[model samples]
Target: MTPVTYATALYRNLLRLNGLGYLFRNVSIGMTDHGDVRNRGFLLKIKCDSVTVLRNVRQKFKTLNLKDKSVARIFCRTLHGSTQNEHNNNIHDIDYITFTNCDNDTCKILRNELLLLPNFVSEEEEKQVVLEVEPYLKRLRYESSHWDDAIHQYRETEKLKWSEKNAIIIQRIRDVAFPQGVKQISFVHVLDLKKEGFIKPHVDAVKFCGNTVAGLSLLSSSVMRFVNTDNKAQFFDVLLERRSLYIMKDTARYKYTHEILKDEESVFKGKHIPRDRRIAVICRNEP
Candidate 1:
């Protein structure tokens, strides 16, 4: 049989399985040659909402008969929440913060002393910064051993030096995002997230970092959500576009718990915003 026909048959078989019809409807199936003329393979990519669903699907998938069993593979991924619909139901009461411009006064609607600067750096400048920091990023691991339990599926490093041109860029960021009189830390923190990585809601440790936290987003866009620690129903989602910078201080920094949602749960203004590998250059003042 042709590859397409085989793939269709496999998809049909999965859909016909009892108790999993709803899940099979969302499964993505395809066939690939892996750029090799001799080898052909069938790939089944399953996105499940919970670990229980994934376990059930895997056990069922194993029971299916395959013409070429050696070449058939099933890959299952469980996102933080299974589907966008599930996420919407949970966040129906949360508020969203839209970006108008870089003006601090206009962006303060979300919280006091919170600001987002869109396109903080030009494309060329972003490339230069990425090139300068690429060495530090290379050493990152898929899972970071941070003391905080809130971070997951992330790689992070701290650097104290930069090239002359990159140093100027950092200084420019400090001038724009940070308070002038405050003593900023010399080292910069780099946090890289895998496509499926996410940050759970948590406040930054006051002992390790100070009142202000500024970050420059790179590689991909994501929604940074802030929820009031005292009020669970009160929250805001801030879209952090690529190359944009965000600063949080005072009430926004201390009174709100911040988190980065997983790709499946990343929605802003009622639209799904798919996420990919993301890197951020973070700067903070002395504690």
Candidate 2:
């Protein structure tokens, strides 16, 4: 779980207990006034007798704010139950999908594993693949019905037969990246994009595809935002770099709808990354 998630969950539980008269209410976050640096970490001094509750709260605090420098040292103190707790409103309720960034340690570990490899293709390989796929871009038709006229030309290939090198890459992905019980994936959908091309938020039809979908991003970097179509408040963004591989399974695939903005950039970790002409080779197992 991310720091934001841990903090949000702890805040939720505290609110629940406060409602039941179990917790001293008005929770406030502030810094310490201690003299020495040794005794200077933020304190959560709640007047409570429940040892389990205290332990859980401290653990959550440690995970949520200790590592990230941008987060504040929140000292939660409970006041009378009648007091309105403004501190509780710090985090928005987020539950549409699970996300992990490329910078995360867990994601780094997983990238080395079989299930989710990030930069599976080399830069040279990406260039070659782009060259091979460029010829089919001419066959693309303008999709005026779905998107704005300025940003909607795309070519979705019919069932494709891979070349010798492409077939080898697929075999390797299957052997290492795919989990057991997954059927073989035979075809790929190559979507060629125009300069300002983008697709709006939508989920793939489960009737035609499997639970797991693997995509290889080539030629450009872009930001794809996954939004909860129902709530609209809960959403997450992921940066898709050239030569990277991404996997969407279970909740990420079925619950959240993904979209890319036309003529836009995504801000991630305080850096603004621009979008470019991207080719997404989407591979899905038969359901």
Candidate 3:
């Protein structure tokens, strides 16, 4: 049998073993075999609505002991594209605050200080921002090693200049989030997180930045968890959707430690939040 045919058979058998044979009706699988047998490669694509089933399939794939044993890249696409716009519109009008058994006082404090605004920028503006800063990010190496042990598997750069259009967007964020008398930091920070990257729980150094830090989410969605510093039991999760803006100020910035959870641990409202590549544009106030 040809290599493509063999791969198709192998995939089907594995799915059946995992009790996911029913996915065959919803999933479309195709393969492209390179010319040489020894150097041949193939691509597998699966489309399904269930994140739980996708996680199970991924776990099963990880059990495969191939000759190379290299990691397989999985890309997820939402089936409902038309509802995305409506979803953005709805989130834009609402403020989402979730707490885990925290006291009413603490929850009220967080609710007042933490703000998440979805669809803060249009799709075209997000694209423009990415296009402007991607070249700088590409030049920098991924910061896997750090002295402070704060971040993991990310690339970051500070940009002082922005295009005229981008500058207007930045100013809007500043006017909305930060107070007028405070001195804004001169440069904007661009951070790119890998698919498997995460930010450990830590507060921003007081000496480096002031009470307010505003960030614009791009590319992917993620969950930012806030843990009370004095009492670890008091914590909450904020869902940061793409094209959304999050502002942490006063109590939310100083009283709590914030971190971006890894994909495996990224669950909000009992649903798994799969993270691909995420880019955040962060702006801060001078200390």
Q: List TM-scores for all candidates, in order.
A: 0.62, 0.56, 0.66
lDDT of each: 0.63, 0.51, 0.67
Compared with the true structure, model 1 gives a TM-score of 0.62
Q: State the lDDT of candidate 2 residue by residue for 226-283, as single tens digits.
A: 6655666666666666666666666567766777656455565456667677788877
Error of 1 at 282 (Å): 0.7
Cα lDDT over the full model 3 = 0.67
Tell me how far the alpha carbon of residue 253 in candidate 1 is from the true structure, in angstroms, after superposition: 0.3
Q: Evaluated with lDDT, which candidate comes out highest?
A: 3
List model 3 lDDT by residue over 1-287, tens digit each. 34434444334433443345456556545554333222322444444566665555544433332222121210001101112322332222123446776775664454346656666676888999999988888887888844689889999888888898788778756754564356989898888998888899999999989888999999999999999999998898888888888888788899899999999999988889889889999999999
Candidate 1: worst 10 consecutive residues by lDDT?
Answer: 73-82
Question: lDDT by residue for model 1 over 1-287, one digit each (tens)?
Answer: 35544444334333322224355555655555443222322344445555565554444333322213322221110011122223243422223354322233323323235555566666777899888877767875689534677878888888788887678667756654453356888899988888889999999988888888989999899999888787766677887888877878777888889999999999888898889989899999889
Of the two candidates 2 and 3, the one with more favorable TM-score, higher being better, is 3
Error of 1 at 206 (Å): 0.4
Name model 2 segments beyond 4 Å from true: 1-116, 145-151
Q: Give the C-alpha miss distance for residue 234 in model 3, angstroms.
A: 1.2
State which candidate, 1 or 3, has the greater lDDT: 3
